[model samples]
Every structure is written in structure tokens, then in C-alpha cells.
Target: MNPIDRISRRINTLIQLPENKEVIFITDLRKEYRQDLKNFIFGETLAVKDGKIVIGKNLYKRWLQKIKTKGFDYDVKFI
Candidate 1:
């Protein structure tokens, strides 16, 4: 699938993850979608672990909001 589709699929799986692990990397977040991340407003909803950027639940929600604002859609909300 395309990067955006993959991301949407991955985000859809966040609901199945443990409450403490509902996170994703900005890089892998888009993967092949090639979406810009330089201006992403992560604020304090993320954490860096083992050199990989990990975002938290709030950030995940914000990520969805950003995507939706851009006209993206999903059958369910994972975060």
C-alpha cells in the first residue's frame, strides 16, 4: 500500500496497543507519503527512546487532527 494508506492502517492499530505504547515516529509516520514534518506541532506529546522519536496519545490525537484537516479519513479513531 501507499505510505498514507500504511500510516492510516498503522494508526488504526493504535487502539490495539497498550495504553502506554500508542505512539509512532514522524519518519515512519509518513514513510512513503512524503508528507512534511518540519512544522509538525508535537509540543510535549512525544518522547525520544533509543534514538527513535516516539509520540504519546495526545500527540497521536493531534496527528489525526492534522491529517483530517488535510482531508484524510478513517473508519475509526485509534487514539
Candidate 2:
């Protein structure tokens, strides 16, 4: 599967997003990245609103950390 698809699935498992919506919002992201760590997620996923990604939060922080460590291999540019 595509890397983005994997990320999407992971996010879905963490937080149930509306199936009808094509794009998730920054409002859906975790409080940390949504508020303070904004740059960490800027272009990692598709953006819909002002600067939100098409994803949500992860209480486990497992995939979130994986993304930060290995996201570059998936073409995610972190600054």
C-alpha cells in the first residue's frame, strides 16, 4: 500500500473520522502538533483547511513517533 494510505489507516484506527469527509482538519489533530508542533505536520499529510492535515490524533503515540523517525523514507519532509 502507499505510505500515505498507511498513515491514513493508522490515523483512522486512532480516531474515527467522518467517512464522508475527504479531508481531515487541523482541528482533528492532537493538541500538541495542532497547537505547538505545527511544523512537525505541515506537509506530512494532505491539508484541507488553513494548515490541517487529513488525519487525527494518536493516544498511543506509536505511529506518531514512527512518522517522525521514518517519515522521510516515505517522502515526508520535516523541517
Candidate 3:
């Protein structure tokens, strides 16, 4: 599979699953990762809302953050 699918599946596997959910609260994340998640991941079909996965944060807030940190390093993941 491709990198996006690989990353998404890896993250999904880390979840408790079948009951418990996996939520990524981006409040504590650095500005760079947030922007990539908001722009690259969330902005694309890589993110689906049909599962027990939720990246908590408003789209507007994410956009504001991206603008605030414009030109920062992108293509980052939550390491």
C-alpha cells in the first residue's frame, strides 16, 4: 500500500477498537504537525468520519493556526 494508507492504518491499529475510540486532541501538538494534519490529512480523503477516530479541533481554528504558522515546515506527522 501507499504511504498515506500505511500511516492511516497504523494509527487505526493503535486504537482500542470495538468500543473504545481513538481521539487525537491537537491542542498540545506543535504548529507544524497541526498544519499538515489539517491541510494534508484532514483536507484530503485520508480522513474519514465513519469510524471511531476523531481528530478533535474545528476547521476554522485549524485554518487560523495554519495561517498563523504559514510557511512552517509541513509534511510532518505526530511523532
Number of the top TM-score candidate: 1
lDDT of 2: 0.47
Task: Report the candidate with higher TM-score, 2 versus 3.
Answer: 2
Best candidate according to lDDT: 1
List the candidates ranked by TM-score, beginning with the highest.
1, 2, 3
For candidate 1, list the clashing residue pairs, or say none: none
Q: What are the per-residue Cα lDDT tens digits for candidate 3 across 4-66?
A: 887566445333231243345443344544555555345433343555234543443454455
Model 3 residue 64 lDDT?
41
Off by over 4 Å in 2: 1-21, 41-79
lDDT of 1 by residue, 1-79 (tens): 6778866667665433435454556555534322333245524555687788765556556655676577343333323
Clashes of each: 0, 0, 0
Better of 1 and 2 by TM-score: 1
Give me the runs in candidate 1 sitting further than 4 Å from their true place: 1-21, 33-35, 42-45, 72-79
Compose the digit string of candidate 2's lDDT tens values, residues 21-69: 4555656544433443355545554435665444544422434565456
Model 3 Cα shift for residue 23 (angstroms): 2.5
Can you give the TM-score per candidate against the true fold?
A: 0.44, 0.28, 0.27
Q: Give candidates' CA RMSD values in order.
A: 7.3, 11.7, 11.4
Q: How much does candidate 1 score in TM-score?
A: 0.44
